[model samples]
Target: GALVYQYPRRTICKSGTSMRMECQAVGFQATSVAWYRQSPQKTFELIALSTVNSAIKYEQNFTQEKFPISHPNLSFSSMTVLNAYLEDRGLYLCGAREAGDAEQFFGPGTRLTVL
Candidate 1:
């Protein structure tokens, strides 16, 4: 079975800080990874997508400058939440997919809190 794992289930930071989280894919070659943010309001936003050997694509409200992603290999990826803020507090999820499937398997996610 394939699985994606994210570390440090939860984190708390100041209003102007940052946090880094990791995602690792096991039992599959994760060709693409999609990053998403779920706010306290329960709204989910697609942040970006990272594909192996291809340029990363960011969604409309997201940018490389704000949510930078690192996809060094087929099995692992990471992202940093820069400049933590009250509005930036949310659950960050990493979804991994194989080469052919448009669907992705998501990790439990890392919950972030800003104060």
Candidate 2:
């Protein structure tokens, strides 16, 4: 069994500030975890993916400077957006792909509002 959980559910941040979010895994080991941001346009943008002992892979337009990630163990991960802006506002989702599984289980996501 694989399950992913995200925290804060919703948040409001001031422009130019930052916000942190967490992801937790339940039932089994999370071999890989992916972070995504769903834009206002309804497009899901990949932020990064972390695998044990391997380098984190970040997608285009996403960098460690703007979005930093931490995968402390097989069952947990966290990410933070360093700056809050109008364009940065979105639903942040974390998906955990369990060992030997083809599907990635997703969390409820963290909805962000920039003011």
Per-candidate count of clashing residue pairs (backbone under 3 Å): 0, 0
- Top candidate when judged by TM-score against the true structure: 1
What ranges in model 1 sit over 4 Å off? 100-102
Candidate 2's TM-score reads 0.94
Q: Which lDDT tens digits does candidate 1 get at residues 1-115? A: 9899998799999888989999999988899999999998787799998899999999998999989999999999999988878989889999999974766898999999999
The 0-to-1 C-alpha lDDT of every candidate, in the order given, reads 0.91, 0.91
Which run of 10 residues does model 2 get worst, by summed lDDT?
A: 95-104
TM-scores for the candidates: 0.95, 0.94
Model 1 RMSD, rounded to 1 decimal: 1.1
24, model 1: CA deviation in Å?
0.5
Per-residue lDDT of model 2, residues 4-104, tens digit only: 88998999999999999999999877889999999887978999989977889999999999999999899999999998899999999999987646688
